[model samples]
Target: MKLNIKPFFIAAVLFFGAFTSGFAQDNLVNSLKLNASEKSKDSFTFTEVINIENTPVKNQGSSGTCWSYSANSFLESEMMRNGKKPVELSQIFSARNAYLEKARMYVRMHGAVALGEGGQFHDVINMYRKYGAVPQSVYTGLNYGTDKNKFAEMSAVLDGMLETIVKNPNGKLTPNWDKAYAAVLDTYLGAYPANFTWNGKNYTPETFAKEVVGVNPDDYVELSSFKEYPYYSKFVLLVPDNWAFDQVYNVKINELTETIDNALKNGYTVAWAGDVSEKYFSWKNGVAFVPNKDFDEMTVQEKAELFNGPKEEAVVTEDMRQIAFDNYSTQDDHGMHIVGLAKDQNGKEYYIIKNSWGTTNDYKGYMYMTKEYVKYKTTAIMVNKKAVPAGLAKKLKF
Candidate 1:
């Protein structure tokens, strides 16, 4: 007999601009460049170690759709790397299509599936393989008349409608429910085009994706590292945003870093997903690190040194990573593109992250994440399967 699963509300995983008081101060300090002098004891001196080519930064703007933006950015970079002319694929094209499909899954599961603006990196691949893609000019998803996305009312109305349908007051679902759902999406996000002209040629979304995007969705893989799962094997990433239940290859923490490094070294950029709620993750300073001391416990000098100088970092272990995951300290909160690497004055290495929250940070929508912070806080990452070393790729059976 089939078992019934009940749906319950969890806190939504949307990224907003609400930052803590400490984070606010960090932002102010970063804005003032209070420690920017080369010789200042309170300044961080960084040199670019490795920088990869990528598309320009774009803002997500009042929307919880960084996954779409970052994944699309990754695809755009992939197209450029493949010798194709760069074109900005619409993030909302993927997001809009994914939403409709997710609604169907939620309804099919009798509302047991999680539904929100949050999604995993694989959601883009899945959407691309199914509905195909369009350029940003073709499907802007801004039918509601705002230049940027604001989905509070839309999310509420959609959730309420799905919940009502799941209740099944009439004991049978109507045939038009899907149409009704589509109508709501079309009203807010604009109707997806059946065919459009691009670059003086008439093309459908699939044709545009094939001839223009020029990247194989199947060539990418999502990977993660945790002690709970066997190394070099696949496991479902346990996160609320992973409502699709996508499986990622699990590797040792060191191997995970090696894979990332190898990928970047081999001219590939990574789609990075991790927790950004830690105090050490400074959006304003455009830097993230694993501090030896907690923010509250640090002296004023130590706090200044956080931005201007380097300190000893805790050695992150697989067990430490697993405990954070099991205890909810590590969460899949945001997604960004890992496009390059940098070194601080003390020669500590950091990964260059391209964020989608607009060009507000010190680096103008980019941040430098410490290697320690990445090892400690990352939930999962996506890279081109070819970027993986041949031996590891063979083991993963990619």
Candidate 2:
């Protein structure tokens, strides 16, 4: 969803310009400084605390293909960690299967479930189980001949198909509704092979899933934090993209980040789902941070200028995460994998993120998200249970 933030940006700038003269700071980085150097020195150090393993980032272009890209990347890492040859599983293949499945579900629910450019991580796992998967080179889903996914045209067509089915224009649900949905997918992303040869043997999608993508679907777990839910209990995440109603473990927001940091420190990667719509999220700069509240204590004009760029703070907490979600500040925006940790020039901790948008940005498709940013913006995270601390693992019933 490309938002029009021009007006907001302009307003924010004018609001801040009035204070620039009063606070003629020495350096650009120094001007936006929220915490004193002395205060910052007391904050946690990620490199000193956690170990990380990472690879190059990937890009999913303009499509809502992050679900596939991120999950497949996680699978790739799983293969690597397990000492198997890493293979780029076809994201489009998983996408086509999910697209068809979601359409059927939409018709079943009479268009109640969302039918758009978004989905949950478990959708990939579920689709892989039911329809199997393919290699990237085998099914890229670029029927229009572009190198990357540009789904605007096809999405409209698919949306139209689902809308038509959900209406039941003919007044009777046909048994072949799913077939019609599958036809639309086949037209866009080539027909799935019933039997294809790979590695000198015939294989179907199910067999390929069983043999190639060896990670067990049951091994992965989703975790989130929200005050309404009882801590240490499991509940379905209420995001629209979670069409499967997948249950995620609910923890206190502090525990969520603690577990994530602990997992990364122990050399385990996390599958992350978070909101990326904030102005502070600079994909080009490869950073995500929360605006400084202490700086906001400044005059309105001063606040506006700082808002135009980046500001750092440590207000990220369990309550902050819940309040953001309650106030519609955090949303289900994008998904990625946090593979490592790094610090900025200010020495603040940042989780090294691998995005699915292909290597197109200055950070080559990665984002360094701060601890506060993760606390305030995350929707959910998936990590291996073994990576969690023994105490936390016991609380989670792992």
Candidate number of the best TM-score: 1
TM-score of each: 0.90, 0.83
Candidate 1 Cα errors over 4 Å, as ranges: 1-13, 16-42
lDDT of each: 0.78, 0.68
List model 2 lDDT by residue over 1-398, tens digit each. 11111222322111001111111111111222332222222232334334354445655654666777887888777777767777788888887888777787788788888766567788888888788877776777877777766666677777887788878888998888788777767776778766787778888888887888677777788888888899899998887777767899988877777988788777678888877656566554555678765443677664445334335576876777778777756667667888877765556777888876555444566667888888888888888777777887899888
C-alpha RMSD (angstroms) for model 2: 8.5
Candidate 2 runs further than 4 Å off: 1-55, 294-312
lDDT of 1 by residue, 63-134 (tens): 667889999999999998898888999999898888888888889999887767777889999999988899
- Position 172, candidate 2: lDDT: 93
